[model samples]
Target: MAIFVHYLSILLISAVIFLLLRAYRLRRLRLPPGNLGLPFVGETLQLISAYKTENPEPFIDERAKRHGSVFTTHVFGEPTVFSADPETNRFILQNEGKLFECSYPGSISNLLGKHSLLLMKGNLHKRMHSLTMSFANSSIIKDQLLVDIDRLIRLNLDSWTDRILLMEAAKKVKRNNKSLVGLGPSRLSSESKMALLITFELAVKQLMSFDPGEWSESLRKQYVLVIEGFFTVPLPLFSATYRRAIKARREVAEALSKIVKERREEYEKGERKNDMLGALLGGEWEEDQLSNEQIVDFMVALLVAGYETTSTIMTLAVKFLTQTPLALAQLKVSCWKMSGTDFKGKNHRTVVKLLDDVIDTSLPW
Candidate 1:
């Protein structure tokens, strides 16, 4: 008992000394104003709590009122500086490699891999960003992607009949004794699943010219695990979700690596497809000659980004459109006009222009 007590005292003293040293170092530098909250855990619980509520802005709003747009706080086992100012964010992005480095929590960084576009820096990031942008340029969208998007939308929409309630469909809720019950073992809402399927299918098609198949479907299932664990506590020892995510991430990377190698071999054999993978493999630029590992990481990051944000936005858009009769009416009218015109010739431009106008006027950004 005496020996155990002695070791505990020593550990406590070491921790105090470490914290004191850290505090002294921090005192030397000028940091933004804000409380760090409790040591280690910090204000993460408060942040999470606020986000769980209907309105999360109060957490930031109260902090901004107390301090400013930029304030210091600790979250996810690290000290962080929060910037709510638009100009400050713009400046940080503009000078990313030079003045700032993108730092995410270990959970995100580990799952995304070191070579992910989001985690990359300097010239590598610039090269990859340029490549991605070139692939997504307006000409490519209009000439290649838009037709696929239209077809996918129409295909999905065919199931939406008057018998199906929009809210119930969006929530994946079923009526049982006048009460709503969630569907599926995963518990993912119907609208979210639909959005994810659309986005994932489109991403795979564009990236590797992969059609909707059992392989792509299997990959998408793994991605659901990865996405679900993104915001969870990063303790794999204690968290089954994190553990599942880590396993899923590894499987995804391995699968993508295999595909990348096969695609490279195909390109060498003069078998080509006009997809992002082909561009990376066959491009003349030295920078475009990425390794299989890099390509896998890039694809994983892009898949996560494309599906998560796009699906959330799509689900919310559907929800809002259902709520707003005026916007829904305008959208329906625009769709009716599009249905009458041939989507191949001059009418293509007209349909695109009409869509642009509808999106501009109907959706509240």
Candidate 2:
């Protein structure tokens, strides 16, 4: 008992000394004003709890009220500054890699790989950003992407029937009960799943010209595992989710690497294609030819970004539209108009305009 108590005292003293040293070091820096919260865990728990609630702004609002729009807090095992001021955010974005560098959590950086565009710095980031933007330019969207989007959406909508639950359909729920007494397997419904499939298919088409198939579906399943760990604690030993994510990330990388190698072989054989993978291998950007590993990492990051966030935005748009009758009515009218008209030149522009309005109004943040 005496020995145990002595060791406990030593541990406590060490922790105190570490915190004191941290505080002293922090004091030297001109950090924004805010509480750092508890030691080790910091304000992460509070941040997570706040996000779980519908009105998450209170967490920031209370802090902003006390300490202004820009404040400091520790999250994901790092000291971070929260900037709510639009001007500060604009400045930060405008001066990326000059005044500030990309500083994602260790887990995110590990999962995304060093070559991922989200972690790229300086000249490399500029080049990749320009390349990505080139693919997403208005010409590409109107001429190529919009056709796929229209077809896929219409195909998905065609499958919808009366009495179908939108959220359940989106989520791809497998079971439904017709009566209190009877329970049986029903047609799957999930807006989120539908959105994921649509976006994933579109992205795969654009990136690799890969059609939706068993292989793509399997890859998508692995990606879901990777996304689940994005915001979790980074300790693999303590976090089963993180461990699974790490494993899944490796599998995803391997799969992408194989595809990239195959594509490179195809390119070398004088078989040219017009997708993003082809663009990478076609020596279009001869100044800096990305390695196979870099290409794979880039694809993985793009797939995650395209698949996850787009689906989330779609799901949220549905949720928000359901809540707001006026917006929902306007959206329905727009959809009706889109469906009734031929999707050509002027009509396509009108459809795009309606889509922009829907996106603008439906986004929660």
- TM-scores, all candidates, are 0.82, 0.80
* Residue pairs of candidate 1 with colliding backbone atoms: none
User: After best superposition, candidate 1 residue 303: deviation in angstroms?
Assistant: 1.3
* Tens digit per residue, CA lDDT, model 1, 178-260: 10111222545656667778989889988988877899999999987887666555678766877999999999998999999
Off by over 4 Å in 1: 65-68, 85-103, 138-141, 158-163, 167-189, 286-288, 323-327, 340-342
Candidate 2 has its poorest 10 consecutive residues by lDDT at 176-185
